[model samples]
Target: MIQKLSNGFKEIMIETIDKLKSSDKRIALAKIAKTYGDGGQTAVAETFHVSRDTIRKGSYELESGFPITDAFQARGRKKVEKGHLPHLLEDIQAIVDGQSQTDPSFNTTQLYTRMTIQEVRDQLVLQKGYQDADLPTNQTLNTKLHQLGYHLKKVQKTKPVKKIEETDAIFENLHATHEAYQGESNAVRLSFDTKDRVKIGPFSRGGKSRVRVEAADHDFGQTFLSLFGILDMSNEHVELTFTASKVTADLIADQIEAYVHKLRSQQEVDTLIINADNGPENNSRRTQFMKRMIEFAATYDIKVILAYYPPYHSKYNPIERVWAVLEQHWNGALLNTQEMVLGFAESMTWKKKHPSVTLEENTYETGKKVEKNVMDQYEKMIDRAKGIGKWFVEIHPHQCKAALYMGLKTQ
Candidate 1:
């Protein structure tokens, strides 16, 4: 068999293997190796530039008289991180969550990262203890960051606002303070807002469907439900809760409590940066809301920062983007039933992932407010930002402790 192979014939065999597909090429190489018998593996390996193990695999398949496949080849290439480092995502999340900055103008939800791609690359090596050789390239890291719902923005987006401030002081304050809380592994940043109520009735919301001016009430009569959406801004995590009662200060606090519990299970949460609009219920002076938050801080031993967007700027809140997507998703769908409403909401995807959805039937009174003296006690616990106190508020756990303790006894 060795004598049968001439110099030209060997060249021809190599050419033939090059032209054939992978499986065919492998089998052909195996056949060529069989001609050499003993030194066959080495000859095929060196000549074909493939491993001896590959030649052995080809030989085994030939003997088995069936087609075989290399699992790695069949699966194709995986994402850079998944193929090389399984922990890449968690590491990147830690890095970005530490470095995330919200847009002051509040136009986009993407984290305005302080670190460039190269810096993040260095952090992986310096901070995460990853070897440079083991890490993906900077470009790959950028792609991964994009996949993780983060991107760096150079310009601030400003709308023809109602001009809330002359020097952009309010916007600047939000940018500065919100950026401050980012990048702490122990801190969780969330963007939350309540979507407009949707009415569920026997009506398709198409162009001209309602023939009767007004119909008799159905079982689910005049059903209007409001949805509270929260986005974990550092990542693509979302939680959506639907409430049948009015969106109240108490309801807002209740949702926060629930979300915090869920987040605590995932990580050690020390500080919460909650980005919300200046809604009537959870505004800085909402006594019940502040009081509940104070209690929440004390119970969980966490600092809560209340970041409210400027007036009439609720559209800029990050969670509003989710509502926009949902509006488009459920626009034409027949939402005449509660099941349909929830089904549409659950089926819709924000950032390519569905949110955890729940329906809360408990009725929370809207006008509930802590008494002035009681609220003054709560206010003592709150640290309102100097100029924009109504928009940006901070409540420390220790302050909450002191305030709650002081309020425990009547003077």
Candidate 2:
């Protein structure tokens, strides 16, 4: 009875296995064989730990013409046996280094388009004796080259510094004065500067360009004229005077005198404030003359105030803008003669209606020096009178008003 039962069981197992093979159910077979309970009781169960029924189902599915094992193994391409990456890297380096000295730089995309990937791959594999699977893409090669310091640029940014306390105070005082009397009818504020000994005729030759004009033949070496100019900020009036030598305190005094005369002649109230850079001439023996003039103006009820800009900051002077305008008119063209230069300077006019004084052929003398002792005394006097109304030897009413408005007590 036992032998008969074993034969029947064997037949059942064979039939099930055949059915699974035909159905192509290898995964199912593997799964069940991996989980079968008894040792060697089923053909696939001992080897793969699966149930006999599962194996029979898998075998039946396999026999149905399905190739599940082959399909699973074909998911990924086998890695090429050799690597061509190192050779590709070498090619990239060679191309980059060769182009470095050229006028324009070439990048990886351009190189890639010039050579096909297959050709590059073949070059690495055959010509360079590199393996196939080791080839790098164009992007990877570019990044690697950059890491090796092939191409790079840098960017920069800057910011303005904030105003300090002392400068802020100075600005505030100036602005307040500007707001109070800037547009007043009889009040005048003038910005003054001296362009001393600027060459009055053709000095330097035209540079580089071979084309020459006949005018270039007339060259006057190292001749200059001194220009003292004042721009009335309030009224847009300009006053300019030219001398044959360096400016002196006397020249400045004379210019101021002329301006005063013009103001009175026009029946305009002579309330004037002179603003100038901290030049020695602006604060010289002529300053004594200016002081006397200020006192004289006080008698006539005309006011005169003297103020100077800080050192090394002359570009803030309004007269510099006037010079820029004058320069633009000249446009680097040479002045053939003194008369021509003077005429061109005098012909410059402002867009706004304003009074202008231009004096030419004025005389100048050098070697007139202010003594160090006098300058020292003047500085001491100015310093001692810093906070008191009595500091100035002579101060006009409007000047006193300005000093007070600037938060300074009479010295």
Error of 1 at 273 (Å): 0.6
Q: For candidate 1, lDDT tens digit of each residue in 99-152?
A: 787767578776777678888888888889999998877888889898888878
Report the lDDT of model 1 for residue 222. Answer: 74
What range of 10 consecutive residues in model 1 has the weakest lDDT sum?
207-216
| TM-score of structure candidate 2 | 0.47
User: What's the TM-score of every candidate structure?
Assistant: 0.56, 0.47
| Residue-pair clashes per candidate | 2, 41
Taking the tens digit of each residue's C-alpha lDDT, what string does model 2 give over 1-411?
Answer: 212347667567546655664234464554444455343236465443456665655655555655434355556643222232324556655545543432133444222123433444565567666666555655554465555455432222333334433454444545565676776778778788887456655544342224443444555567777788978685677877877766776677677666767777766765666666657666423444444344345445666555555445578778988887776655455666777777777677765533354555656564454355444433333221132212122235554344334543211
Best by TM-score: 1
lDDT of each: 0.80, 0.55
